[model samples]
Target: MRIAELSRTTGVSAATIKYYVRAGLLPPGERTHANQVDYGPAHARRLRLVRALIEIGGMSITDAARVLEVLDGGDLSTWQAVGKAQYALDLRRTAGPGGDPVARAAVDELLARRGWQVFEENPARATLVEVCATLRQLGHDDFVGALDEYAEAVERVAAVDVAVVARQPSVEQTVEYVIVGTVLGDTVLAALRRLAQEHLSRNAFG
Candidate 1:
């Protein structure tokens, strides 16, 4: 398809598509002439993925580019990419107004209170700790007390995930399932929790 058709199909602007092509985020289209070019389905897919990383995943261009590199290599499991994307989104969201001493101290205190053994050197860990800080700012201290329970729940979930993955024959398949499962499992568990809560409520009321 021509650039115009590519733009129309992908809902990305022609100029933006050209920029992506220049950035190597999207592959260069075949040159029909000195001024004209044609794109293929791969270009459309790449553009869509780029938009998803930026708009839905909330990743910065640099971070998105790195993720795109990982995805292009196709060596890592899908779960790894999902985890990295989640971590990136968290970092972007918790960036915290760039150096407010009071907020920084509050976040540190929250992490300390929660007994979160975070390595200061690891930005990702710091980002997670900052989420705790954000929660504190929002006046939700329930997580502080529920840390142990949450940790136990996570352990249980991890064990179940491992058992399921163990049934897969190859490492690649296991990784792919883990990646896809990481996202789907969260949704599944959340729905199940609601159902269980409803059942318990009815039983208690009965």
Candidate 2:
């Protein structure tokens, strides 16, 4: 297909598609003639993936490009590639090492209690610590009492995610599943949570 057709199919502007090609987020199409470039289904898929990363995932073009590179490259193991992409997708501003010690201690205890072998430098560690501290500051420290429940639910969700990704036949497909599942899945999960909360609240209050 031509660029216009690709644009129509993707709901992305032709100018933005050109920009993505130039930015290395989407690969250039085949030059069919002097002024004609032809895109295939692969191009269409990639364009959608790029838009999902940038628009839905709220990633900058640079980060999206980096993730594409990681996915396309054979240098990294599947675990490493997916981890890099997941790390890049984390948009939260981590409260660095100097965050509240009480919160850090709580996080440490949670990790220990859960037997999670996460690296100390994982950005989520700091994010969790920051959240705990903020809750405490707001006199909602009891929120952490439900951390185990949240963790258990998350573990089940993670299991489902892993099972789906594991079914992919290739490393590239696996990485794509991970990226899409993490970025878009987050929105899906949040929306479901909101609906569930409303339903439960109505049941309890009615």
Candidate 3:
């Protein structure tokens, strides 16, 4: 198909498509003539993936480009693909609590107490510690106390997510499923939680 057809099929603007190609997020289409290009179904699929990373996942172009490099390389297992996506999305923020000994010990204790095996250099550890510090700063220690309970629930959800991705037939399919599930599922879960909270609030207060 031509660029106009590709644009129509994808609901993406021609200029935006060209920009993505130039940014190296998407590969250039075939050069059919001096002023014409042709795209294929693969291009269409790639465009959708690009859009999902940028629109749903909220990844910057640079991060998205890194992800595209991984996706383009292929041959990754489901675990590798999802892990690479997570790595790309990680902003590697400064350690929270600024290396407070108490916060650091608390984070270590929480992991040990939960029997969770997390890597020392994992970004999630720092993020969780930062959140704990913020909770203490805000006098919301009860929430921190309930962190274990939250982890228990999340572990169950994570197991289910793993099973869902495992059922996919191919790496590409699994990557797509994980990307959609992780990104859109967050919004869906949050919306559901708010709805449930509203219902309980009405029942308790009305």
What TM-score does model 2 achieve against the real structure? 0.89
**All-Cα superposition RMSD per candidate:** 6.4, 2.1, 2.5
Using lDDT as the measure, the top candidate is 2
The candidate, 1 or 3, that scores higher on TM-score is 3
lDDT of 1 by residue, 1-206 (tens): 99999999999999999888777678789999998888889889778768866665445777666545544555555556545434433344535543545545655665676566655554555554566666667888787546557766666887898789768765555543553354456667778889989999998996
lDDT of 3 by residue, 1-206 (tens): 99999999999999999999999988899999998899999999989988987887677888778766766668887777878755555544454455656667888987898788877866667777777777888999899888788888888878898899889898877776776677667667788889989999999997
lDDT by residue (66-136, candidate 2, tens digit) is 77887777566778877876665655644355479988898999889989889876777878888888888
- Model 1 TM-score is 0.56
My TM-score estimates for the predictions, one after another, are: 0.56, 0.89, 0.84
Kindly report which residue stretches of model 1 are placed more than 4 angstroms away from their true locations once superposed: 73-90, 94-123, 137-139, 151-206
Of models 2 and 3, which has the larger lDDT? Answer: 2
For model 1, how many clashes? 1
lDDT for each of the candidates? 0.66, 0.84, 0.80
- Please give the distance, in angstroms, between residue 65's alpha carbon in candidate 1 and its true position after superposition: 1.8
Badly placed stretches (over 4 Å) of model 2 are 93-98
Alpha carbon lDDT at 87, candidate 2: 69
